[model samples]
Target chain A: MFLFMKQHEFVPQVPYGTRDFLPREASQKRAVEGALAQLFANWGYDEVVTPTIEYLETMTVGVGNDLDQHMFKFFDKNNRILALRPDMTTPMARVAATRFKGSPSPMKLFYITNVFRYEQAQAGRQCEFYQAGVEIMGASEPAADAEVIALAVESMLKSGLQKFQIGLGQVDFINGIMEQSELSLVQRQQIKHAMVTRDLVGLGEILVKSGLSQSDQTLLKHIPLLHGREDMLKQAYSMVTNDKSRRALDNLANIYHLLENYGVSQYVDFDLGIIRDFEYYTGMVFEGYTPGLGFPICGGGRYDTMLNSFGMNCGATGFALGIERVLLALERQGIDGTQNCKGIYIGWNKENLVKAIKQADTLRDSGCSVELAVIPESCAQAKESQKSKGYEKLVYVE
Target chain B: MTSSDMDYLTIALPKGKLFAPSAEMLAKVGCTAEDLSENSRKLVITNEKEKLHFIITKTADLPTYIEYGAADIGIIGKDVLLEEEKDLYELLDLRFGLCRMMVAVPEALKREKLSDYAHMRVATKYPRIAESYFHSMGIQMEFIKLNGSIELAPMVGLAEIIVDLVETGRTLKANNLLEVATIQPVTARFIANRVSFKLKFDRINRITEELRTLLEGVVTL
Candidate 1:
């Protein structure tokens, strides 16, 4: 018998929650990452690399119980507890504080990396996923926030997404409202939860029970309805009583005005109820959504206080685009994925060997991906040879 | 791609008490609902004459169905919309099937501060909702996900607090629980698929306007 004997059962096993990227899938991913990288580079943000793993203690700062619970943790060779970074922003903060210490006042760095989380795999969400994002450090101005939002929209567009929206919210505004309320922490959380979920009734009840003035209660009820075009700012300012809350609203309005100036206003709308999931965010927070993807295609916020957790205090805002989700959106848009895969196939016959080798080498040197054909002559001439060989472009050398 | 002469408008109706009333509302807005009843074994109800279709789905999945273009318009709960955080238009409030999402615990546990249960087990179908709500409190609670009958969680020692939707406090009363807090008010809403809301503007707006009129207090309930 030949070396090729009976094929036993193909071990039907894959590492749970992780996946192998076949050629086409990988090419599609590369296309999305490449476009996003160029978009970030064009915006004068240099790329930075962070490790996939970090100390558990470092990654858990202000991440809260839910995300912290979802992180994958293990012990290192030195018996030190480590975690697969659940998000890039935290790691980026660590890097900025440690390595890039006192590098510059206004540092802008972009990153394309995979974050690991232990969550049930489903549509558009994976255990290990790739993200391409840009962080602008040392700037707390509305312009910096708008730049991040604009970059998010621009990057999504660069990846061929036309139908997407950015919902902007200032955490300070929402958190300010909560802070101003004379209620227990649980009540504040409950109200914030309701507001974010658009549960106006629960919000009303909470506000009513707190013994705040009717006007204050009414203002709180309008949080969910405080969404729409640029003109909504006037309405938002009218709701809050405190300067902090008003300032937060004004900050959002400034960001909106800046985006309008950037010609990207069409893609953004304000939602005061849109609170950031992370506790670190101290300013503007936003999420990018597309119809085709189940989760936000991108999410980022200003974490001015978080860097201080790493012993370096500077205001920063950034956003990360889910590369895999972008690729999926492009696919749904009917954008061709195979066009970039210029795969070539050549026969193994000796007479045609030199010619085939030369052509393959020349093509390879010219930046084309070509693989030598290893199919036997008899297999090539079989009844359904192409079905098994699966070559897209075939070259037969004389 | 060719612009087809025919256009099909799809609506995602949350699969609940609102489904039947929403189907009736859809009919008033010029769509057929002959089989929109929840008792019907149909997954998809279509009206070929009007080029309209309805996809009956889990009440919570209505937003996803609309956002992803699986359905063009969805009648979802304000609760689902609040929790999912998608970028869809809350075009109209159907104003039917109203309720409130509240924080409740065993009546005995009401005396304790909600923060007293910090890092303690809380059970709910809305983990994100519960987590975010608690996070905003500057306290954290561990979430134990349950589909239904969350009242059982407190009784069975699974969780200390139960976050759920309550209509009249009757369910909680029956379960020996008290409303420790309210999160938000809940109502059925008409959510539009972003692209469909734009591309099918005229037709969608017409239907939405009709439904809005009917939903308005102008009509006698």
Candidate 2:
């Protein structure tokens, strides 16, 4: 029985939490990537590439412990710990600090790359995912952050995303206020975890356990509650008393107004509770979302200190959009992405085989997508099954 | 709030302790989940006048529905929210279903402080929360995942301590257990699908604002 079961068992699957994209799906994914690439290029972001596998320390350097745990790691023949790049931002930072040293100020670099993470598989999350992103180095102005965000909004709209938003927040505000408190490291971590998880009740309990002043606790609770239109900024303004916290609010407000100048303020909103990926972002942070999707399709922020950790004293900010997630968002909007390009199918009988080749060549020379397939003495088979798979125009060589 | 338009707002709710109070609040602000509650088997209750729909599901499933876009809005307890950790917007704290997630042990083991039980066995339905809780206490604990009857673990010595939800001391007292630590307070939160909050901003904002207004008097607590 054991031998029979072993013989019948189907082995060598695609492995759990991974995926393979069919041609149509791959084209759709490329379309999203191309749209984002064109926008990044138009905004002066030069495309860049990094190794898919790097030394484990290089990939994990300056990353939060959470990111490290998700990374897929292995050892090289040289006994060096190597890992698949879990994210492009840190690798980009490493490159900008080393390879592009003194290249210029504010180097605008972009990439479309796939990353690997050993994460639990679920809806909209695959172990091997693609990210298209841009990183700006040596830029410190609010406009730089504003530029990346504005481009993100434009790219989403340009890609046919009808409804979406970019939630903007500053890491220094909440962390700054907590830094002033006498709460222990564990207490602060617990509270920050609660904030990022949107757990107000848990945050309240932690604040109480830390024995903060009653007014401080109230202020802490009220800060995360700040959301909605610009008026919510007023509540945030009233709550921030520390100089650093107040300055962070001012930076956020400035970015808000800058996005307004860019005419994309409607796509931008503020959230004080956003502190995810805090190990990387030092100041302004933003996350992109559309209706019906739970996870953010895109997330990035300012990481002025990250490059410095890599031995370069430069300021930087950037954003990355997951290719698969953008497709899902488009699907939610009933945008299947097959509407734009349809292939021309050429069916050849024995009588017109040479003519079919010439006709296919003619169509290809005319900048049309052509799919050639031999018919079984009839064109009926190609005609019926082609429409659903995006073959709009058909040519009968016979 | 009902319109002839095709787009309508869908809300998912957990079908237990928080349901009645949540339904009461929803009724005040243009939705009535009680209509579907009249028939125990009906999962969906609709209000044509308001164009609002409610899907009643297990409390643990509310986040999955919101995450997968089956439901645009949900009202669930903070415990489940923390346990599931789905990516939805916590728009408002409904300020209802007030309870505490506590670390409890049998009264017979109350001789030492919590730190004394380092590397001990702890049981809970929320292993992530329990792990973090014990981690903060500088204790190394083995977590045993139990879906229900968490109190029985400590009573029968399956685990030295249990972390479970408690609204009243009656159950713990009947089982001869003493509450040793409080992790977090539990309350019903109004969560909106991240995408729904954008496309349906006007409607989602109105509902969240109305609910927030409802909690103005009791928010200080």
Candidate 3:
């Protein structure tokens, strides 16, 4: 009983909100990531890998204190705080500002790596997750934003997703309204908090208490409902007379036109309420969604101000797709893209071990995944092994 | 699968006081089904013609259904939303099921202010909201989590204070509990899954607009 208790106490377990992807899940993740890497590369983006741990100051500088609670922070040797990166965008921006500072005019980069975030773990969301993303630095034009959005759509397609939409919005659209309004800072923050959570009811209550004119309150309340195609943009244009908001609307239109040229406008829509959770996003923002998933499968936007904090004063835009989310969406849609079948299972009789080894190597050389049996086996056993192990064929060496 | 199944919109309705009004509100938007009542034995009711699906759920679990996309939309109370804190789109205030979350103490305590007692035993069904409220006020207390009949806690000496929802103050009066502070007003809210709000924008938006118009008329009155 004492020995049993000791054994039970020593039983291994993974940390909470983390998972070990066994062979099948790992293969599916790899396949989807491989397709995304190829797609990003075809779009003229080079891949970059960054350290998983960074000084807490660097991450906070890029993201903000809002995500500080979510980071897995610990003290390093020198008592300096270190945190597992909660995202790749900040690290990518860090790389751009430091290593790739004088590389080129338009530095296009991509990364497929895991990030850590301490949060409630659920389907498609874990404390540690994988993301495949790309960034384009040194370009401030709408074309760059359009390229990123188009690539995001293609990334979804490449990951075996058939039906999805990108809800595109510009941050300045709301900033313009806030600037034009005479509300105090606290009231503005309350409105923004309500908007970020998509709490229209709370937004309505705040606006009513904000003492703004009835027209302004109505306009503010209608922002969350401002979602549709190009014609909705015209309606939004008529509602806001401020130059900042007008310029934002025009920027969205230009990006939309470019997306149309990319033949991806069919999968895009204007949702002026998409104030993404990231505070660093300066201009256009977007989130990708599929039918069966409750949360966004991918999201990103332009962050012209992030790199500037790192001392590189240039504009940049990028997007990231959740690998697990893509896999979950594919599963829910009954789409299977990962291949896990071995080519052959080779079994050997008493004197044919050498032959079986040679045959396995030959099959592997010809691009077949062959699994050779360790001990001697009969033909029937070899066939049974092949059937049970999901090998396509069986080779018995006698 | 039938074509209706392809575009079916699933709504999760809280099972208690909010059920009847939520069902009625959905009916006004052309989404109705049979036996969708608070006491009905049926858990799921479908309106095939309107391509609408409704699932009756416990008040606390309504947000969970919406958050996981098990149901596209849900009608839930703000008090439960505060405690559960699920990430969802709070689209509209249905304006029914009015109540307030209050911190109450027994009348015998004679302590009208919440800050009077620096340390006290508190009981609540909404531990998160209760803890956060106390923390915000710089109060220190031990919490005892109870599911129902929170009013009986203070009377039985299990706790000195209780945090609960007061719809009419009649229950508190019956239990000899006096309200010390009001946390926030509570109401039935219409919420939706983030992805569902975008993918089914047209249908959901139409229903929301219809409901908004109806509620606006009521407000004006």
lDDT of 2 at A249: 88
Task: Pick out the ten consecutive residues of candidate 2 chain A with the lowest summed lDDT.
Answer: A1-10
* CAPRI tier of model 1: incorrect
Off by over 4 Å in 3: A1-10, B1-6, B38-42
True-structure RMSD, every candidate: 7.8, 4.5, 2.3
The DockQ scores of all candidates, in the order shown, are: 0.13, 0.31, 0.58
Order of candidate numbers by lDDT, starting with the best: 3, 2, 1
User: Which residue pairs show backbone clashes in model 2?
Assistant: A290-B195, A291-B195, A291-B196
Clashing pairs in 3: none
Candidates sorted by TM-score, best first: 3, 2, 1
lDDT of 2 by residue, A1-398 (tens): 25655765775668878888887788888777888889889888899988999888887676767788888898999999998999999899999999999897889999999998887777678889899888889999998999989988887886778777788888889888888888889888898787776655567667778899998898887666555667877778787678888889889989889999999998888877677654778899988877656678888899888898899998899988888888877776677765565779888777788888899999999999988876534767667646655688888777
Q: Which consecutive 10 residues in model 3 chain A have the weakest lDDT in total?
A: A1-10
Model 2, runs deviating above 4 Å:
A1-12, A179-187, A228-235, A374-376, A379-390, B1-9, B28-30, B38-42, B48-51, B88-221
Pick the winner on DockQ between candidates 1 and 3.
Answer: 3
Residues B1-221, candidate 1: write the lDDT tens digits: 11111277777777768888787777787887566677768777777778877778888777777766677777888888877877566766677788998899887877667677788788998888888899999887889999999999999999988999888899899989988878888888877765455445467767866886776645675
